[model samples]
Target: MKAMSPELASWLRGRTDDSVTVKRLHGDVSGRLFWRVFTGNGTHVLMDSGKIPVWPWIDIHELLRANGFRVPAIREIDTRRGWVLQEDLGSRRLLDVDDGQYMKLLDEASDIIVAMQRRLDGRTCADSIAGRRSFTPAFFMAELENTLETLFFRLLGVPMNELLELQREMRTLCESIDPSSVFVHRDFHSSNLMVVDGRLVMVDWQDARFGPPAYDIVSLVRDSYRDPGHVWEDRARKFTLAKGNMNMFQIARTACQRSLKATGTFSFHYRKTGDTRYLGYIPRTLRYLADYARICPQLDGLVRKTYRTLDKYHGEIDLRDFRSANIPEVRSR
Candidate 1:
């Protein structure tokens, strides 16, 4: 493995009394970097990123902490280089635990999410780095269109002409949705959460947005690493009830729309990176979409529209497996 730059190495040493040894930790989807520093006294985490530096992180840490949620403690922050030293929440996440513990941990996570939402201030999801300033109806439709065309059509092999037509239809369908927006963790999936020392902690929270609350719920339950069981769903519902005054039907509908958007996102990732992991997630996500559609006949037309597009582009992918079936091959720019 490559070594850290001399300046960074010296900086780490100075931070830890010249007793720190740095080992780089792998990053996730984003181009950030993390390092585990072993000091003579104790361990400390060092994170460096050129994008999404410390301000947003500090904002979230402060928000969750003020709301009495269980999250990592921020030790220090440097905004320019995106560096932070936070209290390590340990390695056992929801997925690493046994079935009995998993449910409880997930419940805790849901509770924390609800608490954040309940105590959220007006600017909580707008001015923060994770916040979205543009989620108006037009913006939401454009986002949906980007997912449909770049993620679904262009990446998955739907014909260009058909993609244009589908874009219009999807935009029309999306225009009908006027969801009650709230602070949303755009990527609330499992890996970003950890169960540390019998407490559930949420991490990697630099992508919060002012969008539908159900989007966060969908991000968690419909996560690729683990499926939310019936018990978990029931708990999530209870948590949702405690957080917002929205009815069950509204929550379910928001989850459905979010799931549909996610399917396109996962497909886009797979098509761009040639990684099948995201593709494996589609079935479960589709289950969310299909099940929710069954409850809301209003979405039936949109479902049919998606299927029609899929039918037209069924044979465009190159892989000879489920991952490739009806998949689009995203062209490089």
Candidate 2:
């Protein structure tokens, strides 16, 4: 199917009186399509939602930019068809660049997130989808369980016994977490970051939440798209230490927890759609689990067991009609 529709064109023209040209580009990750548009004077990017629409991200991006975080501006929004025309933050994502360039850019991005944390002193965006929800242990557990069951059990065909035990342990671990609510960007990885004109611009921020500060940081350092080495981790550590003023123990704990959650997400994406690219991340994901286990010392058994289960089931997950799969659904409270 054509990415653009006549109605979409009319909508775009309505937003801008000047003559506009649209060029379709290819990117399929979130079940949506991206397009690069060129105008006489400038350029813009448009995203057309194919199956899984993320229209809310445009609003989130605008809110983050307004709060002094660097992000692409929303030029136009059409939620009816989930299409958005946004300022073209040049497409040189960190993963697209060499290690030296990527690390430097990530260090700068870390500065932005730190600034964002300072601004987030209980001051949430008034016009965001994630208003003032507290990231309590219960809420976090719900998210993990729901994503795991839907993405792993149903889509990956995980055995019932294994799914049950993992869910139980995950819930227990989540509940034991001490509460600290800071503004969180749910998916802050390398893919969602753009290097535009020597500046770092974050994108795909619809799933913003009020959570712990380490949430976004670990997501960046332990990113699956680009397996960064010790150099990036060291830079991230230094950045966090300077701004957050936390010790090694606390930072290590947070990183480990975040990495575990991220591994589940990567596995979910792969199993739900047969996307093997995410599988390449398993090794790194396991490494993160090991790191966390050594630090926590309590989750050692659970971590080792879960890792073995995932490894044993390493194969293509045939996820046909996932939405129709009648798995045990857990709604966020």
Best by TM-score: 1
Cα RMSD to the true fold for all candidates: 3.7, 6.8
lDDT of 1 by residue, 1-333 (tens): 345667667667766777567678766666667877787877777777655556776786676666676677766666676677767666676778887887767767776666666666456544455454435568666667667765556656677776677666566556655466676666777888877668777887766657766666666776656876566457656756776565555555666566667767776776676776776666556555555566567666666666555545543342223233333332344
lDDT of each: 0.64, 0.67
Model 2 lDDT tens row, 167-255: 87777677656466667786778888888777777777767877777667777887766767666457556866766555444455556
Q: Candidate 1: lDDT over CA atoms?
A: 0.64
Question: How well does candidate 2 score on lDDT at residue 15?
Answer: 71
TM-scores, all models, native as reference: 0.83, 0.80
Screening candidate 2 with a backbone cut-off below 3 angstroms (N, C-alpha, C), the clashing residue pairs are: 182-211
Q: Which pairs of residues have clashing backbones in candidate 1?
A: 155-328, 155-329, 155-330, 156-327, 156-328, 157-328
